[model samples]
Target: MSVEGGAGEPLSDSQKREIAVWFLTNAPAGEIHYVAKDVRALLGDDAVYEAAAAEAFPEYNKAHLVSLELPDRSGDIIIATYGELDRNNYLDPRTAQVATVDHIKQTCTKLRPAADEELPSAYIEEFRSALDVELSKYVAEAYPKGVCAVYCTSGKDIEGPGADFGFAVVISAAKRSPQNFCNGSWRSIWTMDFNYELQFVDIKGKIQVDAHYFEEGNVQLDTNIDCKDSTIMQSPDDCAVSITNIIRHHESEYLSSLEESYLNLSDATFKDLRRKLPVTRTLFPWHNTLAFSLTRDLAKELALGK
Candidate 1:
């Protein structure tokens, strides 16, 4: 089996054998195994100690750095012994940043109003701070596992007179491991973005929003919402909860329609993508071919007197 590792002293024959034995004893199924990452979770603390003692590669402590690959239908299982540190020195803790009121205010300061703009920066900053706090609270409580961003303004927009408060909330996070062609290793990734915006205008006020939801590449939705009401300025808490609910409702609708869309794609689009047989194609006799080969082998063995 082929063995690969990061830059360091090459693994000795004894070390390679130790890694292989560790895999055989722990990961019998030959699954994608991360020694440092999974041993504690799947096997226990003792397994972690055992793995550390066996492999003895202390340079990279993270589990993603060390892995063993065992694929089905294989002659010699490929034993990936160790991994390398990121050349770019990238690090990810996989935790969402909790946005505080001070954090939001700092973000607002940099968004200076344009020249000849009459919009009051202080008023907008105050409004954004209030809304940001409420929204941050809602996100922290409702989606503990999700990340949130409050969209603020410098108080100068074509929406006319009143300010606009918007935010983006992303939930149901997952890890992505895309193959890194340069090193032939997988890279971990996560991302956040807004897809579309909806705006509403009226005599009282206006609310503009951008919403998006993504899950397992099954469904994606983009929609606009133009809501006009004075409640946005009247009660920041209520507006924060209301906007969150609106986004949630749209996300629910998008997910609910996923099954129907998948079925339609399977029935129509999948058929067009599938390969079709030629009109003149016919089935061949597979039983005769196998029998003839077996008979020839048997005859040869008999002729050899074995």
Candidate 2:
């Protein structure tokens, strides 16, 4: 657990741990055992609220804030909480912002314990919205690079049909590339197909990545080839076999459909074929150009050759 909130009145380290434990154990239940004021006191006046904020939401450091989930027997509900810590004043010794605390309290008040009468679907949207806000906030803070890996229980239709239970590693590295990487173009490689997107009701554990990099092109592909054989080159001629194998190994199911639809006999046939596929266009926005690569490159970069 880590302290949260603003600079002057943040929660202490111990308090943060305690709050995190409590939230983990008693989530999805509109219940808060510790009082905000009490947390404020424990953190000491100098860092009271900030400490409490950190403890109440360790995910802040990682780019997430704590949220409370309250489910009625018939419906689910949630509320989000955020610290008063401003990025501009991150290193300053300012006190907690009163507005932040008020906002949290107001959000919390809207939630109520589960009741037996409401329909399950009645509050589903509301619950999801609240959860999203909290989750997004936490993720944004914790993973400024927008990369995260989440692990969850796997099962066959855990929630309902078309639902497969399994842990997921969410790697969100969607950031505006620096000028050197793309002349100010916002490029990223973690985009996903509509059907491949993941949904989750609850998440636990800290998100971690092996490495992060900023390069001109798809560093992920580069790293993948490099890992298999250090001599691999960015040019197709230099690593034709490796590149071919890589493409073959990671072939998209949609590629088959595209190839069949457009039968052109030329060296540039594959490129043309790919351009015609909506799936390919969406997933490979860079069109074989510079794009962010999360795991493939990060893993190799961390494993060898610095």
Candidate 3:
């Protein structure tokens, strides 16, 4: 976590309000989002508290320093933990902030015992469910420009370990001008080329798998920032700058949602996966490939060009 606070020292009441106001600005309103800077104009500066919260939280978990829901709201939607500090006659603001921050950090922000990339963090022992690291790639597949910019975070451009967002750039390129996401096939695909773990919790909270990869494929967490196919932006630098501005304005569970979903998987599910991926061993002796089809009729979709 890049942000830090004096965990042992108590904060003044003024500091706490500043932090709360800071959070209020970034809080989501339905589908509309807020930029911290714009909100800060009205709320004043308190990123320090957020930084402290980040300090209190673990690495990777720092992104979720502000996960609170007002009331009667949870799941992937409205996120605010404490009630209006005004209405609650119980805990003082600092006390409430402490309790809420502490509770959230403990419940959420689990680390994915990642021994290595190429495999989903869930594959590691003592691992709990985590979003596919390549979720940015999937977001890119869906939103291309908008959502991908918010979530995708990889490549030489990002200065971190996130191929998902980097791949979102690739997705944007294709989306901005579909003539090529660099030629369409997996051959042109650089991000999310691996057959990593996949699962989703349903309304009843059952874990279900859509696919898993073949054991013999090469999963590269490419961070070179080589794929620039978007007509939407100028360069990788522009991609990062542009998209980060978008994120400051909006948010998706890019953080705590995974924390909320973290759960230990039964040993049995690992024993029985319904599908295998990267069934393209013919292309490269290394291409252990196969896999998804949700759109259109199965037949017509299957009939599209390879």
Name the top lDDT candidate: 1
Query: How displaced is residue 9 in candidate 1, in Å?
Result: 42
lDDT of each: 0.29, 0.29, 0.25
C-alpha positional error of residue 137 in candidate 2 after TM-score superposition, expressed in Å: 2.1
Model 1 lDDT per residue over 172-280, tens place: 2111222210011111111112111323311111111111112122112222233322222344455455555454444333333432343243333434534432233
Query: How would you order the candidates by TM-score, starting with the best?
Result: 1, 3, 2
Predicted candidate 2 versus true structure: per-residue lDDT over 1-306, tens digit per residue: 234567757665555656644553332211222344454554445354554454444333223222222222221111111112332111100111111122234222232222222112222222223323333343344333332222222341233334323222222333233443421111111111111124322222222121222342322221111112112222212222332233222222122322332233344534656454344343333333323332223323323421
Comparison by lDDT, 2 against 3, better one: 2
**How high is each candidate's TM-score?**
0.30, 0.19, 0.19
Give a tens-digit lDDT track for model 3, residues 245-282: 33322222221222232222234433455443236623
Cα RMSD, model 1: 22.2
Sort by lDDT, top down from the best: 1, 2, 3
- Model 3 stretches with alpha carbons more than 4 Å out: 1-26, 29-34, 42-306
Model 1 worst lDDT window (10 residues) = 75-84
Off by over 4 Å in 2: 1-120, 145-171, 182-306
